[model samples]
Target: DTAVSQTPKYLVTQMGNDKSIKCEQNLGHDTMYWYKQDSKKFLKIMFSYNNKELIINETVPNRFSPKSPDKAHLNLHINSLELGDSAVYFCASSQLPKRLLAGSYNEQFFGPGTRLTVL
Candidate 1:
């Protein structure tokens, strides 16, 4: 079984259309993250949920939102998708330190990724 999985491996949509990417993890991790990889392959974190609580929300547009129904699931919803939204969205999970101190690292399990194409 995949430790992290995302639905709709490829998504092709027109501009201004709304879309959502569902992600789930079977690793029972305490934290889940949403990342966007641009055409340049620069991965940037958009949002993170720790134990179902929102944390580490980057300076993403309000059109993007992440909802976590539970610790094992985190879904990314984009409203009024724009051409710039065309990128690979990844879902990752990890068991993190409760206090989030410096120099602490945990291996994150990443999903296959959902490629969003806006035309």
Candidate 2:
């Protein structure tokens, strides 16, 4: 089984449209997360769900919403897509309070990522 999966590795859309990216993990984890990486390679945490509960919101725009159908899947829905939203969205999962401590890498793993392009 796939540890993590995200659909539409590449997404191209026009401005003002709605699009959704899906993610899933079979690792039996209670926490799942979404990260956005800009063209400059700046990684930022978007949303995190712990057992279907919204746990973290990193001041992301309202256009971006995250949904966890169950403990195994978390999907992202972008409303009114904008050029600014054209970035790589990655799905990840880990244990609760997951952190990459000093010199220590944790269990969190990322999906191949969905690259969004707005024109």
Candidate 3:
């Protein structure tokens, strides 16, 4: 039973093509996140949803969007992908404590990332 799972673990597409990655979590967590890891292995949060409501949206390109139909799922869609869009996308879920301070970190369960390659 994978706590967090993503579809199409590997994606190779040409530049300017659009793509979407699906994510699901069976951990029953109220919060889910989409993170992008670049070639340098720097991870940045793209979006976060808590109880199906957008909470944290980072300053990613407008071409990226996150959709969450329910608390247990989050999908990322990228339009007009470019060469710089090539990276490993990760889906993570965590049960946040009631009072999360500015620097608080919750224990997150991450899915096997989807590696996207834009040629």
Candidate 4:
């Protein structure tokens, strides 16, 4: 079984439509995150949830929302999708890293992303 999984891996829609992507992880992690990969392949974090509580990245737009119903599931919603919203959205899960030295964290495990296209 996959440790992390996403639904409806390919989404193609018009510029004004709204859509959602669902994610689930069986890894029993305490933190979950959403990341967006642009057409240029630049990956950036959008939101993070720890123990079902949200910790939104300040730079993320209000149009993007992340909801975690439980520690194992997280979903992302996008409203008024625009051409600029077209990107591959990835879901990842991780646990609090052990204090390696002072400031570093362990790498997160990413799921296969959902590719969204807005035309």
Query: Candidate 1 has what TM-score?
Result: 0.95
Candidate 4 lDDT by residue in tens digits, 8-104: 7999999888899999999998889999999899999888888888865759779988889999999999999999898999999988533234665
lDDT of 1 by residue, 12-44 (tens): 999999999999999979999999999999999
Better of 1 and 3 by lDDT: 1
Instruction: Order the candidate numbers by TM-score, best to worst.
Output: 1, 3, 4, 2
The sequence of per-residue lDDT tens digits that candidate 2 reaches over residues 14-75 is 99999999999988888999999999999899999988989899999898889988988999
lDDT of 4 at 72: 97
| Residue 74 lDDT in candidate 3 | 97
Q: Give, for candidate 1, the lowest lDDT window spanning 10 residues.
A: 97-106
Error of 2 at 27 (Å): 0.6
Candidates sorted on lDDT, descending: 1, 3, 2, 4
RMSD of each: 1.3, 3.0, 2.0, 2.3
Write model 3 residue lDDT over 1-81, tens digit each, in one string. 989999889999999998999999999898999999998999998899998888999899899989999988999999999
lDDT of 4: 0.89
Off by over 4 Å in 2: 97-106
Off by over 4 Å in 3: 97-105
* Lowest lDDT 10-residue stretch of candidate 4: 97-106
Which segments of candidate 4 are over 4 A away from where they belong?
A: 97-104
